[model samples]
Every structure is written in C-alpha cells, then in structure tokens.
Target: MLLYGSTDSGHSYKIRAFLLLTASPHAYQWIDLALPQSHRLAAFVAASKFGEVPVLLDQGQAMCQSNAILMYLAQRVGKLAGAETEWQGVLEWLSWESNRIGFSLPNLRYALRWSAQPPEVLHYLRQRVLADLARLDAAVSAQDFLLPSGPSIADLSCSAYLFWLDQVGIDESAYPHLQRWLARLRALPHWQHPDLAMQAVAPDTSLARDE
Candidate 1:
C-alpha cells in the first residue's frame, strides 16, 4: 500500500495516525500541494475525488478521502471501520464524525488561521465552535468510548478534532469526559507522531488569552 499525503494537513494526520496505531506495514509516499508534483497528475486525479492529500493506493487501486481510507483499512483488519454486527452506536457516531468533527471543526481551525472575516463574524464562529465542543464533551462523558466500549473509527474520527480543538485553546477541560477521553487517546503508542503532537499545532497561549 502507498499513502500519499502532505505533512501539515490534519486530514493527512488521520491516515498517518491509523498507520502507526494499527502497525500496518505499508509504504508511505508523501506529496505536497505547495510544490509542483505528480500528486496533481491525471493518474492521481483519477484515483481521488478532490485530488487532495490522504489518498491511498492499495493493491494498485486508488482510494481517496481520509475517512473512506480509514474505513477500508478498518474493515480489512477486522477493526473499527469494518463490519459491525448491528445498526447501533458505531454507525451513528461514524456519521456524526464525518460531519461534526471532520468538517465543521477543521474548517473553524482553518478559518482562524486565515481569518479575513469581519471581527463580528469571527467572534460568532468562535461561539459556534465552543457550542460544538460542549456537545462533544457531553457525548463522550456519557460513554467510555464512542462505540462497543473500545476504540473505533468513530473515536479516531472524533477525537482527532477534539484534540486539535484542545490545541487551539478551546479549554476542553470543562468537559470532564472529553478531557479524560483525550488522555486515553494520547496514551496510545501509535499516536506518537513526531511532527504531529499537540505542541506542534497548539494555539499560541499568548494570542489565545488576549480575548
């Protein structure tokens, strides 16, 4: 298997984290949109929906989209993303993660990074972000894990953003369940990506406290 991605992207981090955690012995090939590369070639474009990072080539077939790639690997390894016995919490949480975590939270982070929006709009978005965090803190506090009482794609999916939000000075400690859950995820050996630690992306404490 060949994984093509950029180092600075959170979506790319998802795939990288799984590779470490699951100990999948696959070759990782990285590409950068910041440079002129074949990652934008017709062949690569044919393999993905948006020609974005986190595209996987498994057995010579290409798969794009980070969540899709994670799910595929999970099913193959008989893990979180694969076959579940029922229409239960796993599906619900997985779906929730795709939108609630992957899209909204990540976008907020990016917006803050390049926030040309009016100050009022940025403030509003921050409030929305806080609300989302509270909801997630509540959900995780209600259960030990998102599904089946252990790690799942849902946990990977959701926690990645929660951890990211925490890095951004979102003050996740107010959510006891979330803080504990984050500690558990952080404790995993596979999460030891040298360049991807919260310290690397954590919001500047000085800047965050100014508000």
Candidate 2:
C-alpha cells in the first residue's frame, strides 16, 4: 500500500492515524505541494482526479477522500466502523461531518493561517463554526462518542480539523462538551497528534509552513 499525502493536511492525518492505529502495513510518501514537481507527477495526478492529497494506493487501486478511505479501512479491519448495529449512525455522523465541520472549522483554520480576509468574512465563518460545534456539543455532551456506542470513523472525521482549534484562535472553553470529547480522544491509545502522526510517516519541508 502507498499513501500520497501532505504533512499538514488533516484529511491525510485521518487516514494515517487509522492505518497506524490498526498497525496496517503500508508505505507513505510525503507530497510537497510547495514544489512544482508535486503537481507534475503523472502517476499521482492520474490516481487523484481532483489533484487532492491522502490518495491511498492499495493493491494498484487508488482510493480518494479521507472519510471514504477511513470507512473502507475500518470495515476491512472489522473495527472502528464495523459494528452493524451502529453502522447507520456512523454513516450519519460521517455525512454530517463532511457537510458541517469539514466546511466550517477547516475553512476558518485555512483563513486564519493562510489567507488575508476582511473582518466580516472572518466573522461569518466563525459564526458558522460556532453553530457546527454547538451541534457536535449537543450530540456528544452526555455520551462518550458521536453514536453513543463508541468512537468510530465519525469521531475521527469530525475531530481531525479540531486538533488545531487553539491555533486558529477558537476558544476551547466556549464548548465544554466538545473539549471533553476531544480530551477523551486524546487519552485513547495509539492516539497521535496530527503533526506528530504526519512526521512519523516522513518529514516534508512544508510542515514548517503554517496553513
């Protein structure tokens, strides 16, 4: 198996963490997006139609999208997202995360780190982020994970971008339940910080550049 991904990508980190947590055998190649050479790679470009990172090349097949890869790998291992009883709930949260957190917080993070924008634009994104976090807070407040069964790919998908909340000027104190849930995830075995997990694969010079 080969993974073509960027070191700073949360989407890439989700797949990397799953593979590592499961002790899956694979080789990872870091893509330096900063280099023009990266975009010109014929094989990678062919594998990823959208020119995105975290493309998992398994058995001569290319799997795109982080959530899809997470679900595929989890189901293959009979863990993470394997419980039939909670499968629908897991899928629901996965869809929700893609539609909700995947857009808002990561957008905010990107804006905060890499883009210059008007105060109004930042404010608008922050509002969206707060609303999404509130939804997650309400869901996980009285439970251990999103589905009430346990942590699944849903939790991994949702929490990926959140590992950088403080870095993006989002106050964790504002959402206590969300913070608690994050803490629980941090305490889990084989839980590596996103940057740390990325580094474990292979260092890319791009890691030093904030985005």
**Candidate 1 residues 52-79, lDDT tens each?**
8777777667787777777777877665
RMSD of each: 9.1, 5.1
Q: How many Å off is the CA of 2 in candidate 2? A: 1.8
RMSD of 1: 9.1
Measured on C-alpha atoms, candidate 2 has an lDDT of: 0.81
Candidate 1's C-alpha runs over 4 A off are: 36-46, 81-83, 86-88, 197-211
Per-residue lDDT for 151 in model 1? 71
Give me the displacement of residue 153 in model 1, in angstroms.
Answer: 0.7
Best by lDDT: 2
- Cα lDDT of model 2 by residue, 119-178, tens digit: 998898889898998998888888988877687788899999888888778787789999
Candidate 2 matches the true fold with a TM-score of: 0.89
Question: Which stretches of model 2 miss by more than 4 angstroms?
Answer: 37-42, 200-211
